[model samples]
Each structure stands twice: as structure tokens, then as C-alpha cells.
Target: MTQDPSRADMEAVAEQVFVALADPSRRSILAALASGGPATATDLANRLPITRQAIAKHLTLLTDAGLVTPEHGERRRVRFRLHSAPMQVAQQFLAAMARDWDSRLDALKDHLER
Candidate 1:
């Protein structure tokens, strides 16, 4: 049987994922990465108006947050790909929050009608 991840592990990963997405540049990077499998810093920079250096900086943040993984190619050229695990965690958190809000709203409506 598969082992479930602990709550603390999920929370930590979710936090990192959220923090990475909180930045506009990083979000844009993720979007670009999602559209195309993996891209190098220069490739991403060419797609965006940003400089290669700026893309590198954003990539570092994304790597740290576990949103992206860099693969070492010949000459150590880094290619980034999306890490879906953290994204899933973030989605689950949002879904839970929405469900909680819905329950609270239903309770409020019931109280008002009574």
C-alpha cells in the first residue's frame, strides 16, 4: 500500500508552492513552463521581455520552492520542468478553504431564517 504524506509535510510543501506562485514573475514562468515541457533560462527570457539574468533569478526562486526542477544537460545547461506535487497540494488547500466557507455561509443562512 502507498503511504500517505504527513500533515506537516503537506503544509510545508503547500507554503513553498504558495510563496512561489505569489510572485508575478514566477507565475508567468510557471505558465510558460506548463505550455512547453522544459526550457532553459535563455529560452524563457526570449519568450518574455525580461533579460536572461532576470529569468535565472526567478528560476532560482522556483527551484527553491519546489515548483520547478532543473535537469543537468551537456555543459550543465539547466532545463526547468514543472513539479506537479506542490501544485496539487496548493489546489487541495484552496478547495478545503472553499468548502469551509460554504459550510459557514450555510450555517449563517439557517440562523437568519430561524
Candidate 2:
């Protein structure tokens, strides 16, 4: 069946979020931001075991995925802030799929009981 364009766009975003979250380092970076608020790559590197350069690389991917946004802070330091919209969209996508499966299972149960 054909999918709606909006649905397709959301699915694409959710896919990006999933891809970004697939990396453990990326997840740790996000967790650090969530717990400590916005921070630069150096700050994340200090908090986590990853190097500054590696954190910077992961931050780039996170920014592309809309999982994090960069803001210029004092001294022009770019701080990465966690953005939850893409993740929320992904959660909604999973919820929709789960609902679809639940309805199908319920229908099968009813049919078997008949």
C-alpha cells in the first residue's frame, strides 16, 4: 500500500534517529547532555571516555539526525544541546506499529474463539 508523504517523511526522520542511536558513544553523549545539560565536545570528552575529536565527530552525526543542536556560547564555544523531537517521532512510530500488531492479534484471537 502507498504511504502518505508526511508519514514517509516522519519515517525517514525516525530512521535517522535510530541510526544515530545505534552507536554506543552517541548514546553516552546524549545521556551526558540529558543529565548535565548542554555541553561542548570537549566537555563531553571529559565526562565520557571518548576523545574530544571523537565526540566532535559524534556530535556532527547527532546534529544531522536532529538529536542535538549546537548553540554558540561564551567565547564562541559551540555547545550541543539535546533535541528530543526526532526521538519523540520515533517513539510515536513504534507505538503505531505496536498498535497495528495488537489489533491484528486481537482479531486472530476472536476468530479462533468463534
Worst 10 residues of 2 by lDDT: 4-13
Distance from true position, residue 55, model 1, in Å? 1.0
Please list all clashing residue pairs in model 2, or write none if there are none. none
lDDT of each: 0.87, 0.94
Candidate closest to the true structure, highest lDDT: 2
The TM-scores, one per candidate, come to: 0.81, 0.91
Tens-place lDDT per residue, model 2, 1-114, is 999897788899999999999999999999999999999998998889999999999999999999999999899899999999999999988888789899999999999999
In model 1, the runs with Cα more than 4 Å from the true position are 1-11
Task: Indicate the TM-score of model 1.
Answer: 0.81
Per-residue C-alpha lDDT of model 1 across residues 1-114, encoded as one tens digit per residue: 543566557767788888888888888999999998899999999898788998999899889888899998988898999888888988887787689799999999999999
Maximum-TM-score candidate: 2
lDDT of 2: 0.94
Give the Å error, residue 25, model 2: 0.7
